[model samples]
Target: MALTETPLLFEFEVVSSEDLTFIPMCVRFNLDRFGLRISLAQWQLLPYEDRRLLARFPVDDDTEIEPNFDHALFEMLRTHANVEPEWFAPEEAPAWRNVSAVPGGVANQAGLADLRTPDIEDWAQLAPFQRYVLAKLARKPEANHDFVPAMREFGLAVPRNAAR
Candidate 1:
């Protein structure tokens, strides 16, 4: 028999389900970043304190979450923010090569020295997967302490009075 090509691998379709509505940490992060600008009328439509709380999330160095949104959160976001229903592209993502290594340059900043552990230059040589892992870890709301530290290490913004 002649050799045959490998299979195309499993195929699947992703559909939204009624049981859950989800947004990833990174998307949440970006939404909170440039999403809150609004006329007072639109702002008033938001649940009291919910808009305030949403403003802080997925962004380190802001006040911690002190309120939660209703199940209508996704709908609220669409109405309040001037973004398309499904996609939002704020800025070009960090270039792959530029993002290749850990942002080793941040080592010299205050409180940013911890990422330099084991060896000072070690971070600059991390593999792409390592960088990717760090990137995902960098976006989690619960992991803001870790993320902001990395952000500072990368010369990215750290929230005001972030030392807390």
Candidate 2:
């Protein structure tokens, strides 16, 4: 099926439920890229139905949507909805390509190196999504501080920062 590109009507505010704070840079990037200009109050006021609809539709290539929204909203709305978020690093993400095969790029770099061991049979037990998230997080230098904490929370092994 051909991918249908849709224009956005409502601007999104990148508010962190964890912090109750908005990341202005991320917000501006989404707005400028998607042609949206939504306020915090406006976002809060949106009915669940409308939010569900917006989340189901595809934005342009440059826009960023909430990760959970990308997965849950689309899957709930339509079987054919493309649920992948723009932030998702592709299989060939730079970090994955650059690291040695032994390290295996992002997954290894992110402290999930233990995942690569054949002797540790449990390593193969992680869900694909967990593996994907771990790999993506490993390659992102910006997420380094949060990566180990997230790994612990997710029951993944932590990697030491050799640079420190």
The prediction achieving the highest TM-score against the true structure is 2
Runs of candidate 1 with Cα error greater than 4 angstroms are 1-24, 29-74, 78-89, 95-99, 104-113, 117-144, 148-164
Model 1, range 1-164, lDDT digits (tens) per residue? 11114211111101211111223232244343343233444544555444434433333212134222222345675666543333344334432124433433232332342333213244456443334324454433343334444444444444444452
**True lDDT of residue 105, candidate 1:** 29
Model 2, 1-164: lDDT tens per residue?
12224322222212232232332222333333343444555444444544434433432332344333344433433433322223333333322222233224444345343332211333345443334334544554443544454456556443343321
Error of 1 at 38 (Å): 9.1
What candidate 2 gets wrong by more than 4 Å, as runs, is 1-103, 106-120, 141-143, 158-164
In the order shown, what is each candidate's alpha-carbon RMSD?
15.5, 12.2
List the global CA lDDT of all models.
0.36, 0.37
Q: What's the TM-score of every candidate structure?
A: 0.26, 0.33
Error of 1 at 135 (Å): 6.3
User: What TM-score would candidate 1 get against the native?
Assistant: 0.26
